[model samples]
Each structure stands twice: as C-alpha cells, then as structure tokens.
Target: MDNLTHSLVGAVLGQAGLKRRTGLAMPALIIGANLPDIDAACFFWLEGAEHLGFRRGITHGPPALVLLPLVLAGLLWGWDRWQAKRGTRPKDRLPVHFGWLYALGFLGALSHPLLDWLNVYGIRFFEPFSSAWSYGDTLFIIDVWLWALLGLTLWASLRSEKKGGKWRRPAWIGIAVGLAYIGANWAISAGIKASSHSPYGLQADLIPSPPPLEFWKRDVIYRDPETGRWMMIDYSPGSAIPDAVPVAQGQPCAIPDLSALRKEDGELDAFLFWSRAPFATRAQGGGIVLHDARFYDPRARDRFSIALPDTPCEEPAGE
Candidate 1:
C-alpha cells in the first residue's frame, strides 16, 4: 500500500480516540505507521533491480516490528522531555505516558505489515527468521474506493471533534466498512480463481491485478504450467471469466535457455526473488533478459526486466 493510505489509517486510528491516550499519541501512531519503510533508504545505494529483493525484507518482519517502535517511542519521549525543559511545551498537551506512547507506536507499526499484506506486491513477514513472501491479493496497491471511505470518515470525524459531538463513531464505522470491503474483494478474487479454467489444458496459476479507481474490475494474469505461456483477461464484478489473450501474441520473442545462464549474481538473484511469474527472453543484442509475466509489457520490456551476459549463447528462434 502507498504511504498516503498508511498515514490515513494512522490518522483514522488516532481519530478513533487513540489520540487522547498520551501527549504524543497521534505522532507516535502516524510516524510508527510508516516506520517500517525505513528500509526505503536502500535506494540510495541499491540500484535498479537490487531494491526488489531488499525493500520489503527484514524491516517488515517480526523483529523490526518489535524494535522499530521502541526506537520511535524513545525519540518521541526525548523530544517531549526536551520541550518541557525548554518550557516550550504546549499547556494544552496531554500528560506524556511512555507506556501509551510505546503502545501507540507498536499499534501503528503493526498496521504497516497488515495493510502491505493486502496488496499484490508481497511482503516478507518472517524475514531474518525466514525469507518467505506473503500476499493478500485482496486489494489494489492504491484503491480509490478505500481512499473515499477513509477520506469521508476522516472529514466527518474532524468535524465531530470540532463540535465535541461523537468523533470516534465515524472512524470506527469506517474501519468496519473497510474490513467488509476487503472481505468482499477477497471473496470475489477466490470466486474468479475457482471458476477460471485454463484454455491450454494445463494447470493454471491465476493472479488478480486490480486496477486504479475501479475496485470491481480486475485484470488477471494466468500462467500455463505445461507450456510456460502467459495470458491475461479482464474481469468485472458480475461478469463470467472470459477467454484469455496470450501475452506473447504477435510479439517477436525467443525463450532463452534457463540452464545456460549464470544465476548467482546480485541482480539475477534479486529479480528471481521478487518475481512471482518469471520468464526469460532474448535481448536485441543477443543477451538474455528475464521478465516477470505480471509486468510483461511488449512495448516496455526493459522497464521490468534485467539484461544478462550473452555467455551460454544457445539462442533458439523467436517464438
């Protein structure tokens, strides 16, 4: 999920009455919500596909979830103390409770992985302990419907707060609605998978790719196990599963020999690690390129693919 969604969830949690728990409760919740993303700094040193393997690894795992909030709580606590010593602390600020701050931080940090797991881009929940990737495949990375629900509830909650009416109700209701919406999408995805049969008569792996703005419409990626062919189909809420179009149709391509290529390098290892539906092809310069079928754009292969050396050059003819 995007940072905006995470921040909104944190803000919503605060508006749901967690803000009154401590002086820095809101900050603890909001900042801790996005804290797991600290690994984003890896982009400074890791180039290209390197980030694929490193971005959602250990920082999103159990160990970091426990420790990162402590770091955040300590920093927030120190800042609060420093402000008091300088006599710059707001008189209206609630009393600082270190325990509450820690709890809020932990709660906020926990939301990161939960929301991230709801998207197609997998997260390593057991990293350092295990390098396994988990996917919710429930919601799009950015869902407009989710934004609307959170945004409307947040606005209503703020207005209620100003009037001293019931602010917590709106946020709590929004949380319930969000959970139901997620459940509906999960059910829809499962139904589609169950109803879909492979056109090639091979065992098929179906991946639901949600589109922006429209929550009901889905584009599914289907991989044929026997032939290693990729296909795609668009799905709507009430519509039946339609025939899939081959991803390689009319595209000039060749299947590179996977056994011939060296696969020990950092780039190759990273690509393999993150790609859920990987395939190989011949580059224009006679080099080998690897691609994930989910991001397989005939016009933009280079964007989601990596080039490898032309060493074991057994170039089969274009398919």
Candidate 2:
C-alpha cells in the first residue's frame, strides 16, 4: 500500500483504545506495519531475479520478527540506559518499557510487507538465510471496500470514538471484508484473463489505484501459452490497453545500459520490462507502457514522461 494509505491506517490505530495507553503508538504502529520491508535489503545484496523471491531471509522469516526485535530492543534499551546514566541530558532518558516500544515498532513495520506478500508477488519472509517464500496470492495492493469501510469508519468514529463507538472491532471486520473482497477480486481478475485470452493464458493480477474512479484494474504479464508471443495487459477500462495495439519494436527501446538505467532507478526497469516487446518505441524520450511477464506487467517504474495537456500521458514530453 502507498505511504499515505499506511499513515491513514496509522492514524486510525492511534485513536483506537491504544491512544489512551500509547499516544506515540500510532507512528510506531505504522512503522511496525511496514517493518517487513527491512528485507528490501535483500534486493540489493542478493544477485538474480530469483533472489528477490522469498527465501526465509532474516527480515521475512518468522524468527526475525520475534528474535530480531528481542535482540535489537534489548541491546538498544541497555545502550540507551547506559548513555543516559553517563550523560546530563535527562530529557534524553530512555523509556523504562522500551521492550513494548520495540514490539510495537516491529509489529507496525511488519504489517505493510505482510500485506504486500499476500499479493501474488510473494515475500521471502526468510530470505538469503532461507529460500522459503510465503505468498497468499490473494488480494490487490489496494481494495476500495477496505478503504471505504476502514477509512469511513475511522472518519466517522474519529470525533465520536471519544464519546464511544466500537472502532477496534471494525478493523477485524475490515480485514474480514478485505479477505472476502480479495477472493472476489481474484475471481474478477480470472474472468478478465479469460476474456483477454492473453498469449500466455494468464490470470490477471489486480492492482489498486486511485483516480478516474476505476474500482479495479489488472496489469497482467505472461506469454501466451499457445502463441508464445509474450503479451502485456493494462487491464482497465481507463487503462491504455483498452484501445491499444502492440508496439512496432520491443516496447521499451533498447535503452543504452538498461542495467545502468535499472540501477539508477528500478521502477524504470520495471516499467521498461513491462513495456518490453517486439514493438518499436515510436516516440522517443521516455514513456510508460505495460508488458506481460510472469511476475507483473506495467512494473513499478517511476520515470516520468513529457507531460500532456488534458489527458493522461497527454502532456507533450515532460509537460
């Protein structure tokens, strides 16, 4: 999920019964939710695309969640206390219950990545150290129903929760609805894949996005099992795929030093990979396009193109 969304969730969590007990818990919880991302280091340290997959790495592995927090928290707490006793800065004194703080931080950071792993991308809860990857392959990155339910409930309860409203339970209910919605989203993605009959006979993987009011959209990647033509699907009513045709040369131009480009910005690589194909990039400079691959299409490239005036991709090259 996006940072804004995560922070919003954190805000809700802050106001919950927890606020009375732990006002600082909100940021800490949000941080804990995304803690699993610590594994992101693996992407840099390990070589090969496969390395990115779950491998029981330290960050994702179950043990780290429990053990790492304990070790780090204990070490930090001890260190902080020692420093405090040695220093005159009483304001910097450590919290007596740093353990709880550590636990909260760990939990908050862990949530984001766990949720991400639930998507088909999978996560190597135990990476580098272990090759076992955990994946539910269920749910889009974002869910409208989840946003509506949780966001709405949170908003509604914000002012009134002080007066009294069952807010915490809603999180559980929101999660339940999220799970059910995930199932439905999966069904919808499968249907879209069937309808497209992609070259690889893919099952569309849904992505959650805001704007244009498109409830659900899938960016599918896979070779047509039959044609082996390799395809990409920006499967959205508002997406480019709806009225698009294949490019002339490989989708992304053979940009000089693609590796260098990728190293410079991975999102560029993701986007280019998704745009890859037998098509020629007629318009030069940089642009975003979708492609079909096993993992994801229309990958997470952040490079911007010349802006258009009215429509998306409408700006003339960096407008």
Best by TM-score: 1
lDDT of each: 0.80, 0.48
Could you say which candidate leads in lDDT?
1
Candidate 1 ranges with C-alpha deviation above 4 Å: 196-204, 248-264, 301-303, 309-319
Local error of candidate 1 at residue 147 (angstroms): 1.4
How much is the lDDT of residue 35 in candidate 1?
95
C-alpha RMSD for every candidate: 2.6, 9.6
Global lDDT of model 1: 0.80
**Tens digit of per-residue lDDT, candidate 1, span 127-151:** 9999988877778888878888999
C-alpha lDDT (0 to 100) for residue 316 of candidate 1: 32
Off by over 4 Å in 2: 10-24, 38-58, 67-103, 119-122, 132-149, 164-173, 190-213, 233-319
The stretch of ten residues in a row with the least summed lDDT in candidate 1 is 310-319
